[model samples]
Target: MRATRLNLMRAFAALVIVTLLAGCGFKLRGSNGSYRMPFHTIFLGVPDTSALGTELKRNLRAADDVVVLDKAEGADVQLVVISETRGRQILSLNNLGRVREYLLTYTFNFRVMDAKGAELLPATEITLKRSMEFNEQEVLAKEAEANLLYRDMQSDLVQQILRRLAAMKAPAPQASVPAK
Candidate 1:
């Protein structure tokens, strides 16, 4: 009888926990899914060979409602990558003047336009930075780690671009005036 009562109490407690979680509107990560893009077809102005460009292409392709075009012609929207740059700087130095830490930065400038060459979204810049500790003994490993971090940053930037695109509101149609 005691064991049965203990099991019943544990089950009741688990039920209460689940009910509380459900009532609080808890949602799992990525449950929101892909955001809707403003335009149906979009042209990526960046080169396909670049890392950011390639990843952006892949991500845009994942959205079911958005079509990534090869050229700017006849596209509903054109995304122009004005500039992209990557840099590293020494953050800290050791007693012997050796580098003890480094900061890696990636910056991207981009904008959106319509088929008629009117700007839809003005130029925007996104910058991401990361710091890493350096040790001469782990040169190769540190280099690999830095490369991985850069790739991760690129992925994050792609997501940011997508979210920005999703947030964009389509411009209202201009009214035409009749000539007197």
Candidate 2:
């Protein structure tokens, strides 16, 4: 009889917790449904094999209504990747002039345009930087860590691009007035 009562209490508590969470509008990340793209079809000007290009394509393809095109001919929107660059600089040095810390940076530039060559979105640059402590004894491990950080930053950049594309607003239609 006691065990049955305890189970009932536990079930009631769990139900209350779930009800509170639902009332608070709690949502898990990436569960907010597909991001709506302004254009149904988009052409990516970056090479398909590039890291950023591949990530962007994969993300765009995930959206239910988006279609990524290879050629620009029939696409409604074109995304031109202007530049992608990565750099590393020493952030700190030991007394013996050995590097103790480094800053890694990745910068990507891109623009969006319409089929008629009109700029839909101006050229913009996104930069991501990370700092890490360096040890001479862990050179190989540090190199691997840097590569992992870059890959993580690339994924973040892709998500940012997708959010920007989803948030973009189409120009309002204008009403023409007859000339007097």
List model 1 lDDT by residue over 9-51, tens digit each.
9999999999999999998965675777767888999886898
Error of 2 at 14 (Å): 8.8
Give the TM-score of each candidate. Answer: 0.82, 0.81
Candidate 1 stretches with Cα past 4 Å from truth are 1-15, 19-33, 171-180
Which residue pairs come into collision in candidate 1? none
Give me candidate 1's TM-score against the actual structure.
0.82
lDDT of 2 by residue, 49-164 (tens): 79889988988998978899989977888889899999999999999999999999999999988877788889989999999889999999999999999999998889888887
Clashing pairs in model 2, backbone N/Cα/C closer than 3 A: none
lDDT on C-alpha atoms for all candidate structures: 0.88, 0.87
Candidate 2 total steric clashes:
0
CA shift of 66, model 2, Å: 0.6
User: On a 0 to 100 scale, what is the lDDT of residue 3 in model 2?
Assistant: 100
Best by lDDT: 1
